[model samples]
Target: MIFSLPVQQEPKKYAPVRTLMLYLTEECNLRCTYCFVKKEPKYMSRETALRTLDWVLQRNVSGGEYKVLVNFFGGEPFLAVDLMQEVVDYGRLERPNLYKTFKFSATTNGTLANERVERVVREGQLALMVSMDGGAQANRLRPMVSGRESYSLVRKNLPRLAEWARLCTARVTFTPDNLELLKNVRDVLNVAPVGVALCPVVEADWAGHEQALEDAYAELGEWFAAEVRAGRRPPLEVTWELLRDYQQRLICKRRPQKACPLGESLMAVDSQGNVLPCHRFLHRPQQRLGTVEASELPDERWLYAHLKRAEIPDCETCVARTVCGGGCRAVALDGGYGLNEVHPYHCLLMQAHMRLVARLYAELRHDLNFWSGLAQVPTDTLNQELYQLGS
Candidate 1:
């Protein structure tokens, strides 16, 4: 089916919306081997943090978006816990007055669940996402500046980490060397019931491990389907995301939008206040969209050129276009491709994942009651349900 649009009008549904990511600091305790964040002593001061918030809130003052998300990001966000607490407190006191609903979340290394960090997270009701690549794999890939194993420290903090946040998610980044999906998934889920996102390091070379990677994902898909078939909610967040996109384009008959809403409904603010499409582009100075203190608007021309799938020749007729949404921009840029170019392996990985999604959907599609019930589940509720089930 052809999804048509008017010659000159952009749909309201496709307009840029609100989601501000704040990079609290560029300092991290651990130095991961493949980490993209440029570690430095820079931190977002209280003055700069508040300035960024005001700029975001001011943009939403006249807008119709009901909920604006403010994400706390960093080399390790917990390193700047005081700044997070201050911003959350300020947002609480100020946002309601403007009649806008603002929510707070953070992405951390899970090593600094200290007393102050716990208090801020609990009281502020912050949603936390921890970057852990499973047990020993984590120690190998991500180690402290002193070169000590961080696996034990993060593992010991899991119980308290689970309690402090309103919700928690385990973000696992797998590379060619570490393709043990089942083991990694099981290891992380066993420790904490947090939702899980299995992300491949797309920029990493997969020369000899392509088949192995595919096999691992296939095994994971089988396990996921079995868990659901047994009436248990598995905390596979990637499945939910792919399923949502598939339902929208194929089932609901809606047109596809850019998968990564970097310069659109989403954006990131670095520690030095240079606004970027997302944190992944922090090292590329040319990708800087604008700064919080600047009066001029953000430069979104790079985003606009490739915002639609039709703009890319390779994606125009691809089977996974609905869910893949032209792939990751950061990966493309990191692979030394043009802004609109997608890495070949990125496409391969997405195609493999789409197959996994298809298998899981087939398992439930025949059961009208089960399928309908799941199709109607909202994103937030689905996440909450997964959290409850995992916990």
Candidate 2:
């Protein structure tokens, strides 16, 4: 009931969104192999940053009445703190002129988490999502400057990060591949780190790891569901319960032509002020919707027009294509993935979780029969979020 999808919807206009993402800086201090932007410290100019927000106000009026959420993302968003603050300040100042409410959030690594940074978030009342791979081994993948230790610095910064988190909605990630990570973070659950959860490794090519991933999630989901059923909740990586139905509606082949909510309203601006269809595909600069200077807001760029084109081979004939919208342009382009030719391998990870949820849903269905139709689903290609989540 919390989701708006169940409401009878039109087949044509489906991609309504209440969100937007801004790349404060493509400059990241640490080198992450899985980085989608592949950017480093080049930050957004104050003018471009403010213009991006102002454009959203315009889009709301030109578009419709809907929430416009601006999530500050970065190579490391903390590096562009000033610009982040500028957007927050301007968003609050210019909000009254908008078509709807404007909210803020950020996706960052915890290294720059401090009182000053926390103050900006608190004052702006922003939501937060911080990245930290499992306890230490995973942390090794994210090395700081001069080849210095990251875990020690992260450990030292966590308490400050925890304090900032206490004042906002926050989350943490642990992508586990072995028991070493599983055992080392025993104290993580007890820590005041907003909420805790694990991320499934998605960079793998073969999709061979899915069996293990699903098995782990099945066990984890069962445990978490049981805890929640008993009124005690152990938070997992992302709140699976909240996203389950959202994914279901997306993979439902029975649906009709629809615009991607992200394609229509939620736009992502990259480090160079160039706009992208979504954040997951920033690396494919060729697919840009033109620079922020060009619009300062969302527009019907050639890329946007292309994504929804009725003749695009992959989408028009595909059943869930509209719900997924010819797949994420960037993921397809960057990974050299075959469109229509392939089943969007990103679904493997999502379906693995779905598999777990289906099992849990089955166990819980006796008291909750809403998803009885999903009982017979045989495969897991039913997820589009994991591709975007990993991309």
The lDDT values for all models are 0.72, 0.55
**Off by more than 4 A, model 2:** 1-17, 94-99, 155-159, 165-187, 196-201, 237-239, 242-260, 295-301, 308-327, 338-344, 366-391
Model 2 lDDT per residue over 1-391, tens place: 0111222432233243456678887788777555566665578888778777655554445455556677788778878887777777777763333345667777777778766688887777766665655556655567776566576566566566666642222233334344233333334555444554445444446345556665566566656566656655454434443245545664673433432444665678876678676787577655566665663434445545455422244444543332333334444555665322223554554455555655665566553333333332223221222212323
Tens digit per residue, CA lDDT, model 1, 1-391: 1112234543233333366778899899999887877689889988888888766755544456667677788788889998888888887774334556667778788899888998889888888877777787668789899999998888878768878888888878788877885445877878888778777877788877768877888888777766667767677776766776676677666545655566766778889888787767888888787788874455766566655442356666665777665666776878877666678887777777887777767677665543644654446632432221111
Candidate 1, residue 236: Cα displacement in angstroms equals 0.2
- Name the candidate that leads on lDDT: 1
Worst 10 residues of 2 by lDDT: 378-387
Residue pairs in collision within model 2: 15-261, 27-40, 27-41, 197-237
| lDDT of residue 64 for candidate 1 | 62
Q: For every model shown, what is its TM-score relative to the native structure? A: 0.87, 0.74
